[model samples]
Target: MPDSAALVKQLMFTFDDLVELDPMSLGVLIRSCDTDMLVYALKGSKAPIRDMFIGQMSERAGAILRDSIETMGPVLARDVEQAKNNILQKAKNLAEAGAIVIQRGDNANSQVIY
Candidate 1:
């Protein structure tokens, strides 16, 4: 059997993991995603994760997004998964293109230099 660390490394990066992103990196991700999709994606997300994204935006934009999420009503699980996947893919692409860094584990404490 694989070791615990190896198994952990094999796990997929998830939507909740996005909370680890620095402000600038998170901003890049927010801009990359569609507003409507974001509303759906955040529908049932934890308050902290939702706040992280919303906190990065202007007060008006954040309020609008907060209201949208609050009023988005029920969302299909698959749709939420799809939106999360799309956002994750965008973050991966950004990391690949060197537009942002996704620090993990031991590297999480490192600073992102522009």
Candidate 2:
């Protein structure tokens, strides 16, 4: 396999010094994204990876993000295709759809919330 794991590791990030992930998560993403390297990177990360890679999409998404950023925005550039562009963004990215099952304060409940 030529150490696909190495490629996967090189593409990961760390949040709070923890590395956590399940196998199918990355595979599903890789399939759905049509082998798009950027999507794969973001989906495969131990942390919620993002556009912080500096136009960090697969060569594919990067090209797209770069064009849009240069043409129409500076602010938009930050999030044009960004996942965890900043710490807050990282937090947001880290939190997945099923990550939370309940809300506190407004409504007390049990949840993973990532």
Candidate 3:
């Protein structure tokens, strides 16, 4: 069996989990996040993660964000972690407010009913 810390870690919502969110939920999350923070958080992120976010915005906005990411210099690991945590906190707050659903484990792919 896993230790309590390990269990908690396993249950934690991570930045990568944003991929599981529906488009609308993702849009809400993106809108709530600060653009500068997003640029920092996405500094070393995977292509899919970057693409998912950029794809949700208007062409001009996406291009600007993409350019920002491309031009950004090296970011501190701690800053990246902080930005991701802030975004995750926003997501948790949104979920608690019934504005979005964060599906996990067995419900990860479940459909949402209106």
Candidate 4:
């Protein structure tokens, strides 16, 4: 796995960066991401992105995710942030491994090659 510093330097999309993507592109990335990464990202992410991820999953998976988030008690801000970072890192790794493609947003000028 790449170091976090190098990962950040590479500047792939973090969860926060999802907001910049069009719905179709964002949905593709969400569906391609690892399940655990989706869980982690959902826990820390805001409503729109969270909804997008849940929407991409099956009914059962979506229900389970919703329940998990509901029953999950308070988590530290830093931990939540770390979870989001982990998702970003995992996506980067997957892209690097040629498991998936991480494309630029429709509005972006340049693509980040993993």
Instruction: State each model's CA lDDT, in order.
Output: 0.82, 0.35, 0.83, 0.68
TM per candidate comes to 0.83, 0.25, 0.83, 0.68
User: Candidates sorted by lDDT, descending order?
Assistant: 3, 1, 4, 2
| Candidate 1 per-residue C-alpha lDDT over 39-74 given as tens digits, one digit per residue, 9 for 90 to 100 | 878886889989999999989999999999887778
| Model 4: lDDT of residue 77 | 80
Error of 4 at 104 (Å): 1.7
Candidate 3: segments with Cα more than 4 A from true spot: 1-11, 105-114
Error of 4 at 37 (Å): 5.3
| lDDT of model 3, residue 44 | 65
Candidates arranged by TM-score, highest first: 3, 1, 4, 2
Candidate 4 residue pairs that clash: none
Q: Estimate the TM-score for candidate 1.
A: 0.83
User: Which parts of model 1 are misplaced by more than 4 Å?
Assistant: 1-10, 108-114
